[model samples]
Target chain A: MKILITIQENNVAPRFDLTSEVLIADCRDRQIIGIPRTILMTRPSSEELCGLIIKENISRVVCGGIEESHLQYLVWKKIEVLDAIIGPYLESLEKAKEGTLKTGTILPGAKKIRSMK
Target chain B: MKPVSFATCNNFPVTEILNGVPHGVAILDRDLHVMEMNRFLEVLTGFANADARGVHADFILRSNIGNNEKLFRNVIETEEYLSISGDIISRHHKKIPVHFTVSPLKNESGDPAGLLVFIEDISALQCFDKKRHNMACLDKILGHSPKMQEMFELLPVLAHTDATVLITGETGTGKDMIAEAIHNASKRSRYPFIKVNCGALPESLLESELFGHVRGAFTGAVKDKPGLFRMAQDGTIFLTEIGDLPLTLQVKLLSVLDDMEFFPVGGGKKVRVNVRIIAATHRSLRVLVKKGEFREDLFYRLNVLRLHLPVLREREGDIRLLLDFFMREFSTGLHKSIKGYTPKALNILTAYAYPGNVRELRNIVEYAVNICQGAKIQKEGLPRYLFIPVEEKPPTSADERRDEYSEKAMPALDLPAEIGEKTVSGSWQDVEKEMIVEALKQTGGNRSRSAKILGWGRTTLWRKLNRHGLA
Candidate 1:
């Protein structure tokens, strides 16, 4: 499966339309197959991002908040969207590799702060 | 009298105080991570305090603060207040215009502890600015003619009330835009604005589309679907081409309008809804009713507030205004810096009667802008159909216009002796320049009233004046 995650620096971008970087990972059987490639976009545009996703033939997309229109368009194109997931992109990628990432998962506070508390 | 210190006021509920400020407030730690945020900020960003704590400020705000963290970090280092206006992506992924005030937070030792951020939503102010001036535009709709000016004055009055609006106009006369302007200015602006074309879908499908369907309602109905009325909720529903609405569905729509309730396709339960109806059509509903094809009661009900959009040609002096407007619009969109139209091209455009109205004019400008290579759009840049002699084209209902301002139409002008001699043999450009020079001379160099006399936009007249060296 080819998983694409919208990122801002090290974390998942808060909004898909405003993301300028994306991490594309190729995994198999819920495990990593190779080193993930990072793609940098010239601008943050939902239309261009949609075009890039289709051009790259991404199988699944993991990101934070996304508008309903773009989400539906991606889903209609047969690509799975795991949206509204917050925290670092690496952790999101790990979850995706393990096939455990779910939509609307807020990770940082849940795993780090809640555990300490 | 006692002066309270921060230590003395430590018992006060800081979170509650921050929430009561009426503006979004967030406290960030040294690394620009979210340490705490008030209820207003939480609601705006869609991140509860529990989940948002310890998250990076950029992720929490999702604003145009900076592409990276260096600019924000600099704000703390410089220890100066930074205020900027930009858009913030809300939790729903909607862009919200806002103003931000970022200030450094200091500790008891006067060392920087974190940052204090204040956000003020300004979308309402932006909306107000667009509708502020009593000029030739309302939102996106543009016109300068007396008839359009009358309609503009009446639009705001009609938008304030809940009366069903019936917009009648020729196709492409911006009836949909008028309908939208009403919805945008109305009290229900916050709700969805739904549109449905009565003639686009078959009667059976359209019925289900307008008034949803229950599970197993038909062969394709594996799941229940809430229709457009339900989707619109407390908003406005625009029914275009209302004349084509099936008579059976017309009765259902009338009942819905009367009682604010309707039954979904194959559903026994009645669905109650509150929605404003705005219907439009090019065809006359009265004619349809006379032919027994439309319900008279429904037609009258929809006609509570009628707004008729005049055809493009009927709106005197609007042709040149719209031409310049669309020319600049397409030029900017296509990344071209188009100066203006050539004299011959301008004459052909201003002379041609646009049967398709504003929409066709917009398409023509877009095509010309795309094909144009030089600073000015030439005759070849326009659609070839525009170059067809007026007599050769098929006559339209308004084709009686041939007698009014056919290709032979020319404003009576006292031509200069030299120009009068060339009237029979000179190029159209020479005659056009002479006509402009004479008009300016007749108006005593007053471009505003000169444009009116020539039935052209002020910008168009000014460009022609400059071209003729009469400015």
Candidate 2:
């Protein structure tokens, strides 16, 4: 399943620039796959989010953390929204590929990932 | 329920509640003496009724129940109900989580006569909470408070560009941590993080220390050495304790910031090093600039990127967190098994104002680890001064500070004596002659430049040279 990772800023790519999307994936096997993952701007309004949802055909919308407005927007768009999964993004992305990701991790333990998965 | 007289209610109601009421009750007089306790108190204590009246609260129930005397007294003073939850061990050593409240009594004149304390065991709820909230700390470097979440959000935005950062806070307040976080999250993470403490070395040595000096530069100059600027080429140079940089050095630093190229102290050849300078200072640099001690231009240059560290006291929320973190760190490093702090120690810590901030907290934890024997650290295990803050660097004595200032002023006032030392056992009159000759020899005998270098009036300089042996 393809996952859409919300990046804070586009300028952070290159050296330590790992995808924050994979951070929402599976922490056990964090992989980036180097595929062109859509880096959506953060906390967009409902209409803006809806436009991006249709544009990217984003099956799952994952990010570091989502505010209530953005979370609601994604939920309405029928795009699965996950936030709070932490770590280098590549690791989270790999978890998403494996389909074992628990949502809203923030760090590692705010909510129980193992129990949820 | 006919109202019983004070004397009968005291001894009997205490014993009666042990059997009748589900809650624990203890009655105290104007002096907090246990005039009467209910049957529930007896069950809670596993004791039979006796002459338990007229005993002090601490003596009647010494092991546990409400250990915080001040909290208890507050209830009495406020004439309001006060509730708190803590561990309570019975006579049989059975631990019960007690939620206790104290309510005061008023006389017929509507004045306080005594205090009444009620206790309810809350072990189950408190235990469940402990298990739920015991997860490992996630953002150890950034901290775990909502305040830190705000800082974490700023880190990425600050890293988006190459703006020079100026971090300000009290010493040991994680200014360096924020600087490191910026670099780590910035485009410059791959480059080196070179740090220099401006206050560590004397200003004379520091000039050469920061800007490389060529061989034969001064009396002790042995070989050419690269300064931090050359070493940190293309990386971030964190100028820590920057407010301490001397006035002379501030000018050089200002020029360096403006031109982005600084000549080595001794090297006739100019050297250029490309580096981003991030400065940090605990002192009020703005005040220093106003006093003309720090360069104003340099202050503006470094102020391009500003980050302030919040003191630990302001974040009373983080104390419990930092305490736990330091405890774990000390436990692992010392290989000890300290579980936590006793009620008294935690109270003492909560009351304390940690003057040294996080560094002081770390030191306290390590000190406790060395002496702690059991799982819990008691109040006595902490350093004596912790009971009272401002332990380090006691208040400066006014008279003593005046003497210290005069002691430093004494040397600068001895200009005649310094000139006399140049003659060294020669006639006092000829001493003036000898200084000019030495100055001339040192400066290739250029009188024009020597007159400018020395603060002597030009006419006075010539008169002195003639008056002495240096005709």
* Deviation (Å) of B379 in candidate 1: 1.8
TM-score of 1: 0.51
Q: What is the lDDT of candidate 1?
A: 0.80
Compared with the true structure, what per-residue lDDT tens digits does model 1 show for residues B223-335? 99999999999999999999999999999999999999999999999999999999999887887899899999999999999999999878989989999999998899889
> For residues B1-471, could you state the per-residue lDDT of candidate 2 as single tens digits?
112244445466435544576777787666565666777776775433353454445433433332335555667788888766654544343556678777887666687777777877677788666533321121345366676667667767876677788988766678877776666555566688788999999988998989978898988889997888888887778899998898889888888887778888778887887788888987777878887878888889889988887766677478788888888889888888889998757765655556466877788888877777779886557765443211133433323333433353211111134322432334434534555676677679777766654446778778877777465
**Clash tally, candidates in order:** 0, 21
Encode model 1's per-residue lDDT on A1-117: one tens digit a residue. 899999876778878988899999988999878789999999998899999999999999998878878998999999999987877789999998888998878775433421100
Give residue B376's lDDT in candidate 1 (0 to 100): 97
lDDT of 2 at A85: 45
Any runs in candidate 1 off by more than 4 Å, and if so which?
A: A1-117, B1-137, B390-471
Error of 1 at B119 (Å): 14
Query: Which regions of candidate 2 are displaced past 4 Å?
Result: A1-117, B1-142, B389-471
lDDT of 2 by residue, A12-84 (tens): 1111112222212212233434445444345434345446666756667655423455556667877776554
